[model samples]
Target chain A: MTAALEFREIDVSFGGTFALHKVSVGVHEGGWLGVVGPNGAGKSTLLRTVAGAVRYGGSVLVDGEAIDGRSQRERARLVSYVPQRPVYPQGMAVFDYVLLGRTPYLGTLASESHEDIEDVWEALEALRLTDFAGRDVATLSGGETQRVSLARVLAQRAPIVVLDEATASLDVAAQHSVLELIDRLRAERGMTVISAIHDLTAAAQFCERIALIDDGRVVAEGTPGEVLTESLLGEVFEPSIRVIDVDGSTVIVSLRVEEDPS
Target chain B: MNAGRPSSTRLRWWWVGGAALVLAGSLVAGVMVGPIRIPPIEILGTLINKAPFVTIDTAISDRTEAILWEIRMPRVVLAVLVGSMLSAAGAGYQGVFRNPLADPYLLGAGAGAGLGATIAIAYGPATSGWFIDPLPLAAFVGAIGGVALAYLLGYTVRSGRTAVTLILAGVAVAAFLTAIQTFLQQRQSETLREVYGWILGSLNTAGWEEVELVAPYVLVCLFAIFIGRRLLDVLAVGDTEAGTLGVRPGRIRLVIVVFATLGTAAVVSVSGLIGFVGIIVPHTVRLLTSSSYRVVVPLSILLGGAFLVLADIVARVAMTPAEIPIGVVTAMIGAPFFAVILRTSKAVVS
Candidate 1:
């Protein structure tokens, strides 16, 4: 079977500085791939390039089709990305903001129809945000806002979902809820999930396969146990850590601490 | 969510319908009293008589007939056209820029129009002592040219033009043009009075020709913006998000700018640069409705027409025989009202 998303030799540079250096990876259909990397490892750039937000060299394929060649609208229909810091305009109602996810399906000259509203309502319901439908996003709590962001991507109904550190600022409870929701969606809907996660423990628990990136290159790519080894993480992150199995899933727990001298 | 009265589609229609009713009232009032106080009944009769196949017995005298049909009606129509055009463009600009303070003329239209009118006053047939003012024609061209220059400068920065860069480019262009205009005004001291009068803005010379000149452009541009108001809502989130959602922000913004500029230039050419109606009317609409452009655009048109019609009435009657410049009247009214809005609402950023 064709992989759901494939980045073959993806290279991105900014004014002679490389962001992603001939990086390549692929995920099978419906697989959840978590990207773990140190700062400046080009994890965010990889997702952004695949989302076609930035100019990139080499080929990115979504379900065996080149992503760069597709029109923006066509790509949006195939893939939806939730950015780390999405700007939500003040005074926008939750329902209205989520309805924007239906834009790819909408004509340029047309507004949201009843069917589009129905999809928005369903997405909100999935995220347990039905009660806050008419609330302005400005007044929302952090957890609610994160859930609302997820609800927007859920409303898009794209086959492949990419979360680029979208839950980094989220609290553990909110992060759990978001990851569990994505897990449920992948299981029930058979959709692909690719994420750039800072939480090694969360990535170990949630992701079936993990890709370790260091200095704009993928150092390892395999199942959580295969790739998220103590030596590999120690070498890449410079943190002494231990990987433990909590039931069937791997969990990364810090074994040592480097305290600030000050 | 302040839960400000359930901002659904039904409530939005109510706002539109309410504004339309107020606009009708203002239109009638605009026609009835202007230098000559024609009675309400006579005004109503004259309006009905002019309708197809319906000629009522002449309750209004012939002078009243000429005043109502030829003078006040055209002026009132132009007022509506200009008011609605500027306000819609203003609201559209605010949406594009994602800033409340963004006005219709923020993209060099006002300065360009003034420069154009000044050039005509200083260099055109005014030296021949002809009453045929070439200011309007020149103003229109200069307004479009100013915006074209801004667009070119903004476009060179990127294909997906960001609002901030475009706004900066516009301000730079407007400042340059204004400097030139001032120099021209100083050189032609004899024509300075008329140039100053034009800069202060007025609706004194409004007529059928002016109305005809502005109607098509304003109507077409307004229709396009109304159809694309949803994109404006998406745009408020920012361009990259808008693009990721599959709505090309640059393309939509360009379409809006083209039509809005055309309509605005037409009105500015006919009526000079009446201030505040564009900024005030749209900001008022946003306050009443949510910040959704879908609701703001149409309401801006309706309320803007009403606001300017009322402002023009004040311009004519405030001093009672000595008319003030309509722009002066708007600035006086709008400045205070804007301050009040700022004090009351937390939405105003600057």
Candidate 2:
């Protein structure tokens, strides 16, 4: 299978600080890849690089075409990114905000057509947000807002999706609903999904492959069984934890507290 | 949900309808309620049949006709045009910056224009006779000069800049220019009263020539902003997001800033600094139209015009023979409403 998105020796810096350094990864078409790291470990930076939000000192090829020369709109046509927490303008109805995802496809100052409205409706329906279409985004609960953000990405209809902690703000039920929605989208649409996730257990359950990033570098990349071992988790996360297989599923649970006297 | 669409449309129409009714009523009231107090019917008759070519005598005297046509009519017209320009410029500025607090005066344009006007008032009379009479011309030149200087300063910060730095620089420049204006006002005591009156702002002395001078510039600015309303929508989202949506956000912002400044300068030139109309009208319109520039811009223009006409009417009639400054009336009305809005509305940064 051809790689849907590939990053070769990517290095990104902000001001003088390095966000991501010499990182290389390839996501095959229809692949579900999870990026797990500690806070400030450049996971979001990696996703932003793929989304073409930041310029990097390396090559990013989408479907064998070099993306360096393509405009942001061209990249958006291929890859839709969902930020962790999307800030929306007040008084914007959920339906209108979702319709903004279709901006890239709109022609020359034209209003959204019936087809565009239908696409928005479809996205809302898929996220079970049909009832909330007319509701103000400012009035939405945290989880509902996150789902609305996802619905916007769905509306874009891009083949590749980059989600930076897309479900972090959601409650437990909403988190499961969002993850299940992503699973359904991947299976139905054959989309390549790359997400920066915080929950290792959820990552183990959902992702086909996991890439462990630490200090702006990917330290491990493999199947969940290979990458979610005790040593790798310990080294990358700096957490005193034990990885256990419960009902044939890997789970990470905190063990004992370590106190250091200075 | 589909039912909501029709209701939204109806609500929008109702707003427009209500504003139109108020505007028409205000126009009648404004014409009839001057010191001479011409009846509405006589005023209308005079307007229709009292053109240069045709003469039909009405209840109103010839002096009253001159007062209505040559004095009050032009002043009212100037007020409406300047009001529309300021409000539209405010709406455009708010959209481009993605901040409700943003106004057309955000880039030192007003202060620059203020300086230019002050300078012209000080120097023009000594050099030329014709230039000494109208203060708005000097103000207009100053307004443009101020905005140009602000843009130059802002451009020096970076090749492509954001709204925050531009606004900060404007604050600094405005403060600096205001200090100089204060110093000049103090030195010229005889002209100090005139400068003070100018700063307070009034449409009391405007006539046909001033109206004709300002109308075209305001109209052109309004037309340009109306045509670019769609691009303004893209800008409501942040620059990066707008860029991803195929717009060069930096270029769009530059164009909007220039046009908004031009519109603002044109209005300020005619009316001096009519406080709070620019900031308050746009915010009010946003609440009514839900921040869609397509709706907000046009609505702001109509409502803004009505607001100023009403204010100018109050200025003319409230004190009877001695007129109150139009700026004083607007500030008194706008400041309280602005406070209420700030207190009541949930703060959304963008």
Candidate 3:
């Protein structure tokens, strides 16, 4: 089967420094692919390239079609991205913010239709954010805000959802809940999910496959059991890393490298 | 499930209707409540008679009629036009900048116009028979030029960092232009009163000619902004998010800034640097109603019209005959009101 989303030799550079250098990756339909990387490892840049938020060389294809020449509105219909730090304007209502997801579908001169409003309501309901609809977005808690961001992307109704460390700001419990919600939604909708998650354990648990990137290159790409090993993570992370299977659950921890007795 | 959230369509009508009613009331009051007291009923009748295919005969002297038609009506209409124009532009600036305090004048338009008016007053022909006066023409060119210069400077610095660079460039440009204006004013001491008068702003000279000059630009800009309001809402989320949502923030902002600057320059050319209407009106609308550009943009147009008309009424009446410049009235009112908004509404200021 053809991959739902594919990035081919994507190269993104900012101010003479390569953020992503000739990175190629793909995720099949209904598959959750987690991208794990060290700091400044080009994960966000790769995701941003797919979201068309960054200028890059090489092609990003959706279902066997190159999207470079497609209009932004057309691309938006295929992929919805939730950035690492979502901007929820202080005065905007949660409903209005989510309703913005329908922008690609609406004409410049047209107002939101009944169906658009219904879709927003559906997304809100699915996220259990119906109660927060009228509240100012600034007033939402971090987890709630993350959920609201997800709700906005969900309302976009794109076939592929790309999240760049969406749970980075959330607490541990909230992170799992948010990922679980996304997993359940992806399963129900059969959507392709590509998320750059910082926590390896959570990524292993939620994502079907994992891509470990270091220094603008994917060093390993396989199922959690294959890609995440003690030796590989230790090499990439610099700190002494340990991966242990606790009752069939992958738990990754980084131990402080003891001062080498020089 | 959505009860707390007011139905947008129904609430929109109420907001629009209420604002429109206030604007109508303010316009009528503006025409009627002048130094020459004409009965409100008679003024209404005279207004009705002016409408196409309508006639309402009331005992009214030729002097009152002249005052109503030539003097008060034109001024009132110009106030509405300038008020609405400034508010629309202000809201657009605030949206694009994502700064609540951003106004139409934030981009050096006011300072450029001030310099232009100063140059015209200091050196240009004092009187002319030309269809369009040289002062407004010069000011229009200067305002657009100032914004263009700022944008170019911003682009040159870093094309990607426009929002911050543009604002900084605008400040630099405005300060430079203002310095030139001050030096020119000091050199031409005779034109000091005239230049200051223009800078302080007024609608006292507003006639049918001035009204005709600015209406089309105002209408065009308002129409463009009306269509782009939703995109403006998307822009409030910042560039990356807006781009991800398929709206090109740079393009949309450029379009909005162009139209807004055009409208603002047109009005400022005629009315001078009317302070605070741009800041006060849209902020007021956002406070009382919703912050959604869909609501803020249109309601700002109406409420701004009403706000300025009311302020112009105070400008005309408070000192009586001496005629305080409309800008003074707006500042006197706007400063306190804006402070109150900042203090009271954390959502807006934030």
Candidate 4:
């Protein structure tokens, strides 16, 4: 079967600066790909480009169909996106906010049906947020809000999901929970995930394949072991790091340098 | 089925009841305490007896009937309609921008209307029969023109068309128009006081004719906004997200802006720029209810109507023989409440 999403020679520019240049990537059905890069490395821009949020040169295909001419709603129905930080309007109940994912299903003047309500409940339950259904979204913690954002995409029921630094604001436990939730969704629903993650270890732990990006180009793409080498980390991340093999698995650790006062 | 959880239906009904009570109270209070001081019982009697033009054996004079039906009733109705339009427009603006601080006048509509009215008055009331009509046709035309200009600027110069940029452009446009209006008012001293008083807003001279003039536009705009309320909710989730849901945010925003500006211009021309009902009423409704435009839009209509009626009552009875401007009453009530809401709630503006 063809990959769920394919980006071929995509180039994206913002004002005078090129954010992404001639980047080619593919995500297979039920695959989990992790993108890791430093700040201003065009990580978010790449994902946004694939999602058709920004105007870009070149082509993106979902299920072997070109998506360049597709409307936002049509693209949305194919691929759901969970932004880095979700901002909720005040006094918006968590349930109502999540139910907004059903916008594509609603008629112009009509309200949500009972099925929509059930879907909202199921989404909240999947995220273990049933207790927060009536609570205001503004009262949620960073982790809870992140999970809620995920729930919104889950309710969209799209086959592909793009998570843009989705767990960056969460605590370690919450981050693990969020990743596990994504894994569960992928396994149960046969969905594909493309997460732009910052934590290299987390990326290695969760992603089936790792794509290392630098200055808008993909430097390496392979299994975590093949791509996350000591030299590669040093070159791409500009950090002193050691790669060790522990129990048939490679682990990367950064070494902090001591400051010299001369 | 969660225990003690209020179903959306029940909560909506509760809001409906609360809105109905407020409307009834405001209407009774509106007809009772004008300069004529008709008792609540007498007003009710007049309303019921006027079905087939019943001749009441009470001491209610012809001036009293004229005041109640011809003057106060239409004024109150106009206030309700204008209030509803402003609040609905404010809610629409807030939804479109995804910002709590957005008001109906964010598109330079008020200033443009003001400039239009100023220019018309400067040219003198005897300029044309169209000008002599109490509707402020020039102001309405200017408001629509201002929005059209803003849209043109947004389309031509801006690349991505951010909501923040639109709001900034609107503010700049308002300031520019207001400056021109002020200069023109300065040149024409005879109409300056009338123009100034109108800008501050009043409901003193409203009658059935003014109500008839503004009602159709308000109804049409309200219908359009109501139909598009769900679309507005989609918009609140950011433009890209809205697009993913198959909505063209740019096109939807244009439609909303045009319809909302029409409603706002129609009302503002008649009411002379009554403030805060647009900004405060919808916001207060949102605070009590949820941010879903489904609930906010309709509730805004009802609460907005009641709010203005109550404010008009206060404007009329506060000083009795000498009436304060309706805008003054709204500002006095709205500004302090707005401060309180901002201080107490964690609602982010953008």
Order of candidates by TM-score, top first?
3, 1, 4, 2
TM-score of chain A of each: 0.94, 0.95, 0.97, 0.94
Q: Candidate 4's residue-wise lDDT over B1-350, tens digit each?
A: 64465433224778878987898788777877676677766676667777785665656677787778888889888888988899999999988888777888888998899999898778745745543563388889888877777766766664668777787778778888889999999999899888988888888888888899989999999998888887887787788767766678888888888899999999988888888887898777766666678788888988899999989988888888888999999999878877898678754443
Better of 1 and 2 by lDDT: 1
Q: List residue ranges in candidate 2 displaced over 4 A.
A: A258-262, B1-11, B46-64, B127-137, B158-160, B230-233, B337-350
Ranking 1 against 2 by TM-score, winner: 1
Q: What's the CA error at residue A53 for candidate 3, in Å?
A: 0.7
lDDT of 3: 0.88
Candidate 4's TM-score = 0.93
TM-score of each model, in listed order = 0.94, 0.91, 0.96, 0.93
Per-residue alpha-carbon lDDT of candidate 3 for residues B203-267, written as tens digits (9 for 90 to 100): 98999999999999999999999888888888989989988898878788889999999999999
**Regarding TM-score, does 2 or 4 come out ahead?**
4
Candidate 3 displacement at residue B235 in angstroms? 0.5
C-alpha lDDT of candidate 2 relative to the true structure: 0.79
Between prediction 1 and prediction 3, which has the larger lDDT? 3
- Candidate DockQ values, in order, are 0.54, 0.37, 0.65, 0.44
| Predicted structure with the largest TM-score when compared to the true one | 3
Better of 1 and 3 by DockQ: 3
Q: Over 4 Å off in model 3, which ranges?
A: A257-262, B1-11, B129-131, B159-161, B341-347
Winning candidate number (DockQ): 3
The 10 consecutive residues of candidate 4 chain B with the worst lDDT sum are B2-11
Candidate 4, which segments miss by more than 4 Å at Cα? A258-262, B1-11, B39-42, B45-63, B125-135, B336-350
Q: Which candidate number has the best lDDT?
A: 3
Reference-based lDDT, each prediction: 0.85, 0.79, 0.88, 0.82
Poorest 10 consecutive residues by lDDT, candidate 1 chain B: B1-10
Name the runs in model 1 displaced over 4 angstroms.
A244-249, A253-262, B1-11, B127-133, B158-160, B341-350
